[model samples]
Target: MEALEAPPSLAPDNRSVIFTLSIHGREAECSVLREALEQHFWVQPGAGDARILKAFADGRKRITAVAERKLRAHSDEQIVLTSADFEVRT
Candidate 1:
């Protein structure tokens, strides 16, 4: 990410960018959704982190959006999916 290329004077390490998703669905639906996320975004599993399903740069927005749109098709009155960004101290 461009932030990684920033000079130490800019203090890139002072902040972090994170992408997140929250979905409400059955177990089967959740599994399929996870696969869809990996297929559409530049994400890798968050190792042992349970809160983060995947992680990627802001530059991956295009594909992330496309994947979100695709997942919309599977939504119903009971299923919900959403994403948000957070800037936090590193």
Candidate 2:
């Protein structure tokens, strides 16, 4: 991740400095995280995989760790968190 230059209109100060974060090479992880959130928390029952939902019942942290490990093994880029990844590991 890199910080994009702040707009000239926004002046830097001792209190705060504003800048946009430029992220790269992690599209796969972002997609996984979004899918997990939608499937696990935003969807009604019967809308997502039963195994994934069961894994999520274990805890958010466990699910997130599984997702990160899966991504690390598959690619060089950093990963975001997800619940379905826990199901896959189990």
Candidate 3:
């Protein structure tokens, strides 16, 4: 994200942080795992984005599994990810 912020020329299309996981293992475990990853990123200085977008899910659990996130909106979200945003894509 700092790399993005460093350049005034190409303002990133929001915070383009993408999280992808193929949870053939325990879906529940991996869902939380993904959250931890997101939090890890959020701990950065300018890691806070205005919006969070999760675009993958596990049908059985109805929880987020993967995220193609862009968090540069106005309204802010703390940690707004569910397990329904992920699916087995591999």
RMSD of each: 14.9, 13.7, 15.0
Of candidate 1, the 10-residue stretch with the lowest lDDT total is 1-10
lDDT of 2: 0.39
Task: List the candidates ranked by lDDT, beginning with the highest.
Answer: 2, 1, 3
Model 2 vs. true fold: TM = 0.29
CA shift at 52, candidate 1, in angstroms?
14
Off by over 4 Å in 3: 2-70, 73-75, 88-90
lDDT of 2 by residue, 1-90 (tens): 432233211112211111222335343432234345455555343343443344344333444445445555766554444444535542
lDDT of 3 by residue, 1-90 (tens): 211111111115543333322223211112223343244333333433432223222121233212213122311332234323333356
Minimal lDDT window, size 10, model 2: 8-17
Highest-scoring model, lDDT: 2
| Error in Å for residue 40 of model 1 | 9.1
Best by TM-score: 2
**By TM-score: ranked, best first:** 2, 1, 3
Against the hidden reference, what TM-scores do the models get? 0.24, 0.29, 0.19
